[model samples]
Target: MIYKVIQINFFMKGIDRGLNNSVVVLLIIQI
Candidate 1:
């Protein structure tokens, strides 16, 4: 159970990073 939770946490972090990257890209485009 603990391992599964850790795996999910890492997965979520990756998704968050992707979202942040997209936001950055959008800002660059708007500039």
Candidate 2:
């Protein structure tokens, strides 16, 4: 559950930063 929260936090941050879709996907995949 904590890991899931972390992933969501990162996802939100990536969107807030306007990161590329592929980069966000990669980040999620990496996590």
Candidate 3:
């Protein structure tokens, strides 16, 4: 169970990073 939670957290972090990257790209385009 602990391992599963850790895996989920890692997956979520990756998703967050992807979203942040996309937002940065959009902001750069707008500028």
Top TM-score hit: 2
Clashing pairs in 1: none
- Over 1-31, each residue of candidate 1 has an lDDT whose tens digit, in order, gives 8876776676567677775777556544644
Candidate 3: segments with Cα more than 4 A from true spot: 19-31
- Stretches of candidate 2 above 4 Å error? 27-31
Model 3, span 1-31: residue lDDT tens: 8876776676567677775777556544644
Kindly give the stretch of ten consecutive residues in candidate 3 with the minimal lDDT sum: 22-31
TM-score of each: 0.54, 0.68, 0.54
Model 2: per-residue Cα lDDT at residue 15: 94
Model 1 regions lying over 4 Å from their true place? 19-31
TM-score of 3: 0.54
- In terms of lDDT, model 3 sits at 0.63
What lDDT is obtained when candidate 2 is compared to the true structure?
0.87
Which structure is stronger by TM-score: 1 or 2? Answer: 2
Q: lDDT scores for all predictions? A: 0.63, 0.87, 0.63
Q: For model 2, what is the alpha-carbon lDDT of residue 22?
A: 89
